[model samples]
Target: MIEMTKRIRDLEVSEHLRTLTHERFGTRGRFTLLERASGIGASKWKNFYYKKQEATTEMIAFWIEKYPEDESFLMTGKIPPRKDGYPFGTIPPHVRQTETISDRLNWVIVEWTSPRGAALFEYLEERSKHQIAAEEWKKTVLGEQAPTAAMVEIVCKARPYFAAWITCGSEIDSYDQVDPTCTRSIKTWRSNLLKQLMSAPSEDPEK
Candidate 1:
């Protein structure tokens, strides 16, 4: 099963919404229908739908809520209904994705940190530390001390505020963060877990 937040990176939000509206109501929908159904402003959605602007996480949530069952389809253009029991945004322990793991980590960290009221300056500060810690982690792991699952779990659970920052949006490439600075930290953290996982005698598909 795919992570709830993972979706087709190139799929435009407006296009997905259009298809969802068509499927959910059993008819092709127009702007007025979309606006009323999703409770979104026409101008704003039109801007995104027409490619004048990209839809942010906030706008996409409205459309997703309308056809929650098709969330997987909306995310990947795949036919599988995302009617899995798990709720949106929470990582299911049973699904393992080497690819989506990084973004999931970012989502966990950001959500746990400034669950709300995150300011630009706050992000700027935390992002820098996250980068530096990652670089040092690389150096450490390259030696005799590879990362342990315990080490990764601590950071993932504790939700350290300093050292990483990424905003939510459809611009997420391959479920990786599009930090104007970079998605390197996500990759680096992924690397930390991958080293340990790959070295294990047996693999845990459920991880």
Candidate 2:
């Protein structure tokens, strides 16, 4: 349990009420008020709790009205989101070789931040870019013609504004705007394997 106080940590004066919302309406425990709390739409509330997106001033006001005694929270002007670059480091060669996707996710969103002291407190801070070199990797690994930078960049940075489908879940979003590293050649491997399977003879002798 994250012992939340009357004032929650890391939230700005503008976003401060966000923490209170979480505290009063604990997301997991029994008797939690998240769904029961009335005002903001479920989408906005979910976005705020999971760090999927920042809440707007209008939404903030909605919550502020719910907690009238703390209405003074509105006086604090909206502080722009923190810009300290968080999600970057040269991925070690060994990590690239041995780490699974889950490992990479944990590295960025958990192990990396906890040691650096940014996990809970600076939850809303900015993240560093994770742009992979797709064209170069294609030329070297798949021996395929490299696509134009524009093409790969277009695909790589193309995560939808809202998730198109549930991915189970990922730690991709700190503030939910970080560009996810695209799966380029992995798609190629899948295509080639499918072709190989289609061309192979079936083992059934009875046919």
Candidate 3:
């Protein structure tokens, strides 16, 4: 039973990683077992105990950033009524208004504080489409399709912005405010997580 459970947990880890790579990196590939275990905190096989617990904490933080009512606790330092309402400092301070497309709509540009942030943003803007197709070809634990030339183009286009952002300063307090900074420590952890997710394999033979 223990061996059977371990095998099932391992498969779960793989599928999660595969889905994440496909959805986030736009790649269809296989994940090494180690990567799957680390990526989504799916190491346990005792039901949804681990995933549910961790996701709950993360979701709380996510919601705080997404709404205005959540701002009072953040801005005023008042204790929140809900247990989840811990004091979260100002919104990441990474996003700012870029050129305005119209009255209510403006392009928001994110200032990356580290190479990983730049990498992630670039992947989202340029490499994402290719990743979509790449996800379709995922095998057991490796990716078959390499990222395309068009994906490379998208990455290159984002280079200028990244370089410019770095030169001006890594932190963007606002549209005009920039600070030379290093978010490498934070990014390292995030990258490790991604590596895990990108390497997972799926249980569903059809997938």
Judging by lDDT against the true structure, name the best candidate.
1
What clash count does candidate 3 reach?
A: 9
Q: Write the per-residue lDDT of candidate 3 for residues 1-207, one digit (tens) a residue.
A: 999987665555444433333332332221232234233332332222324322233323432433333334433334345323211122232232211111001011223122221233344544455553422212111223333444333433544323223333333433222222224423443455467678897579877
Give per-residue CA lDDT, model 1, range 1-207, as digits (tens).
Answer: 364334445445456765654433322233444555456776775676566766667666865654354567677677663334323233322222112434334344333443222232234235545443433333222222443344345444454321233223222333222222234534544555467678788857998
RMSD of each: 17.5, 19.9, 19.7
lDDT of 1: 0.43
Poorest 10 consecutive residues by lDDT, candidate 3 = 99-108
Q: Which stretches of candidate 1 lie over 4 Å from their true place?
A: 1-15, 22-29, 81-207
10 residues in a row with least lDDT, candidate 1: 90-99
- TM match of model 2 to true structure: 0.27
- Model 2: pairs clashing at backbone N, Cα or C within 3 Å: none
lDDT of 2 by residue, 1-207 (tens): 365642343245436656556544434321223333454566666667667666566666665554443444444543334224322332221223223432233223322333221122223122213243422322322213333434333333333221211122322332232322333322343455468789898899886
- Give the number of the best model, judged by TM-score: 1
- State which candidate, 1 or 3, has the greater TM-score: 1
Instruction: Give the local distance difference test score of model 2.
Output: 0.38
Model 3: residues with Cα > 4 Å off, grouped in runs: 27-165, 173-207
- Give stretches of model 2 more than 4 Å off: 1-11, 29-32, 74-207
TM-score, prediction 1: 0.30
TM agreement with the true structure for every prediction:
0.30, 0.27, 0.24
Clashing pairs in 1: 8-75, 130-163
lDDT of 3 at 70: 39
